[model samples]
Target: MSREVAIRVENLSKLYRLGQITTGTLTHDLKRWAAKMQGKEDPFMKVGEENDRTKKGGSDYTWVLKDINFEINKGDTLGIIGKNGAGKSTLLKILSRVTAPTKGEIKIKGRIASLLEVGTGFHPDLSGRENIYMNGAILGMTRHEITRKFDEIVDFAGIEKYVGTPVKRYSSGMYVRLAFAVAAFLEPEILIVDEVLAVGDAEFQRKCMGRLKDVSVNDGRTVIFVSHNMTAMQSLCNRTIMLERGQIKMTGDTDTVINHYLNTYVSTSSTKVWDEHESSGNDYARLRSVKVVDDEGVAISNSFIEEGVNIETTYQCLEEGSKLYVSLVIKNQKDDLIFISSSISEDVWSMNPHPLGTYKTTCKVPGNLLNDITYKVTVFLIRNSTDVVYTAEDIIIIEKTDPGNNRRGLYGKWGGLVRPILDWRTIKL
Candidate 1:
């Protein structure tokens, strides 16, 4: 890939007013506008609070995005990730020219196409075919160029049958497919996408992901993708940036950024107890609590690598004739799942009907099986091996540290995720 800068953002920020009346917002904008009219600096640029939707801020205007900065290479793909209200969509909107920043500026080298929220860049009254032509025109494409790529776009979208239908009547999946197809095939130098694939099924999601890769790799385009799907981000993006509360948190390689995001921003617990008011299951079952316990049945946050661990889950079964089984997922600090165990792993629990009653299940974790690191456990209650009755993701976490008691001496760093002691007899004859 060429090292030429395709896009550069410097000190970007977005401010929004909370209530219906944007008097405060208008005041700030008017102040900025008057200053600009006088050829003076904008005064209300950096005076907004952070955009945290949870807690109420003192200011009427909050910065949806604050001091954001990044540079993209000509053909590099960058992934942006964060929780809700983290200014992900705002950033994309600013880049697509749908919204203007309150402060700072972005420099672009080429035409840009963005597939943001649902029904973006499309008229409800226009047919899919007409919208395609319109979007192409907006991207600086001539009618002849659009016509040359029309068939390919329709075919790739798998909506040739609905090409003439009004996009308002199309399903969400169909809308996203057509939107993504247009954004990708329109020949824009930089393509920006934001969580639109979540509206489609897994198959269509895979197709869109493949198209993203092809656009960046085969066509030498820059792509900026925003999604909560870590797997897709890791697969498609070579580099990533994580945002938190309208600010940039981390920016680097995809794996490193994703790891930091999962371990730090993602919430985890060592023990969880559900209250009666909280509902975690359907009519079939209800989860009560999940915890990591030692051999003596006492919950412990610190566990050794050379010792056994137990995961205890308690739940109340509600319906009769429900063949319920438990599944446990063990993951390391990086959110990489180490192993998964189902109740059916034991012959006794396979295909057995769990009657309605309060029950507690315990799963054992052997020593020398996992590396020295912190681990989280996710619990799932399944019925008939198909239906999920209840689930608590990352219900508990445990810190597994090395105690130097294993057969492998604590000399050099032990690689890999596990530390199993295999049977080996060296023969020197």
Candidate 2:
């Protein structure tokens, strides 16, 4: 038997006008008239360098998504992974018709239901029971079908006591649980889910994953899941699709695709900096710059675990007479914080005053301390235990390697924040 295509997207693109009024207005009308007469797209449609609002001088009309093309077969579970603003949600939105594409075409078969946000089809004034039925109908389910799944939906959501309560009264977690329950129970031919599970508790997320697995494997449905949680994505998806700046970066087997996405799609060191002029926030000072160097004092962009290296972060004090505290957080490629050390931890400074000037702090990561993998560094500045001057996350990239293990243990099952090499003793048991 030949495989059936559940979804086919060809040259799909989405565009938006930057720095313009979205709704009707006299100014917008005049601009549109002038642009049409001049035979131009939109005055705001200037294609060039992209800006990151998360950083300084970022672009206004950041392309949340651009041209994208992919195919998902029946019963295939496709995982979408990328950093924030990589257009993962935008692609899923276009696929589910929550938003129309700016260009290209998409062919989808059977009924499609998307759980893009909490209380998606739910009316805040309506009771839970009513919203379930309403959402079921919206998903193309008949009255009888909804009736059969009503109890299971309520039970799975674990909100039986508040069945008749207005959805507005429900907490965020409750709202998502009820909304997800309705979407998942209806058993649509194509299921589109965003990062809804991220807000749920750990146990709830596990339960939802289990139910989704059953739906895709046993019921032979197609699923498109977008999430930042790499471990969960790897566990649930057989195939993976990675997106970067609205373009498809990689698509292949789950492990290979996810790894490629992590290694390649993540922010490069040269692209991200911790300069004081570029980065600032509440609670602490600002990170002036971050750099890594070897024993010979040569600047290094990447390093192996066996190479002991020096990591340095420069900071600037914006105000005088404020307690200064700074921390360095190291995380693995999965975005999990491995170790966080702060100036407070060392007790190097008391109520002492720090002059308003630039200063650099360095930490040494000795060889053999870290296993082979990609890691990131985040810098934070705190003042008086409450004020946060600055916090810059995922600003630096570090690579580690253990030639003896052959990279197998680097992605091993022994999960934790760190993979340390401690001495062991075995007395013949």
Candidate 3:
């Protein structure tokens, strides 16, 4: 059996004029209108460059998205990831029909309820209760249908006391909560959410994630999610697409796409070194180098999951009697922090002050402890156990490969941020 497509985008592109809202002067608009009447392409569409914000282009036009083609299958959850200004919101808006694409077409099979931004569909003068019904009506839900879900929506949003208040007076968090509740409860066939969820509290965010997953899994609805939180993306989306400068750079399983984005777009390396003239530090201490090493103390960027790796940092203390300690923060490709270790736990040097001299701190990460993924290491130097003196953020990147030796015959991708070989025993009852 073949899967049905929920949404199909073909040759989708969006172009915008710089420093102006309208397309251009009335004369340009007339020319575009004439071209449309003549069944010819717009004259200005061929003059713009890709939407690269860093570089200066000669033309006044820029393509926010170009040649974008993709399909979302029914009941599939899709994630869109990219750096800032990568045209993520533009694509979502186009799909939601909030804006028209400059060229190409998008065919959608179901009613789309979008939570694009805070208060996107809510009326400021209207009460939350009124807005809920209004949004439902816009989604083609009957009054009876909206009435049936009204209580559940208000209850889920935790705004029972303020449901009758004008939404303009609501806090940003409340606006998001109620907006999300309305969008999710309206029973739209397709749901589109942008990074607006970040405005809510952590608990509310978790609730939204749970609801998103429930709608896709239990209700068989299609979902498109956009977020900078990699951990959330990994947990919610089975497949993901990475956008670079308004184009799809890669699309595949969540793990593969996320790993590629982290390794390729993110600036990281296996080793970071500062010369004698340039270093990262204050007046008290200076960082010289940070790197990942093998058991033999040789620098290596790649290692097997079964072979533990070591992180080493070298620094020099400029002042005598400086109470300093080193700390290491390890994060996976999904940008989820695995663990943080500090030398302040040491018994001898932790409490005592240090004399002026060069020092090396090594943290041993045992094998079978970390999952097979790319890891970024950040080094922190603290003085007097409270003040952070020097910091090297994401300076060292390490890739851990799964050799299958520790799989114990099991196959497929292992779950969790850490894959430790814990002790387990079982007996038949």
Instruction: Point to the candidate with the largest lDDT.
Output: 3
Candidate 2 TM-score versus the reference: 0.72
Clash totals in order: 1, 10, 0
Worst 10 residues of 1 by lDDT: 345-354
Taking the tens digit of each residue's C-alpha lDDT, what string does model 3 give over 1-429?
Answer: 699999999999999987764645676789889999999998888898999987889988899999999999999999999987888999999999989998999999988888776555579999998999887777667899899999999999999999889999999888888888887888889989897666777799899999999999999999999988898998999899999999999999999999898867654678888898775899998888888899888999888988888888888888898888899888876666778998877667654687888888877889988888777787898888788887777778878889999778999998888889899999999
- CA lDDT, candidate 1, residue 364: 88
| Model 2, span 33-137: residue lDDT tens | 899899988654455234243553344445556567789899999998877777777788788787898668999999898878756667999999999999888
TM-score of each: 0.63, 0.72, 0.63
Task: Give Cα distance to truth, residue 368, candidate 1, Å.
Answer: 22
True lDDT of residue 219, candidate 2: 96
Q: lDDT score of model 2? A: 0.76
Query: Which pairs, if any, clash in model 3?
Result: none
**Against the correct fold, how does model 1 do in TM-score?**
0.63
The lDDT values for all models are 0.83, 0.76, 0.86
lDDT of 3 at 308: 88
Measured with C-alpha atoms, the lDDT of residue 96 in candidate 3 is 90
lDDT score for candidate 3 against the true structure: 0.86
Q: State how far residue 377 of model 3 sits from its true place (Å).
A: 11
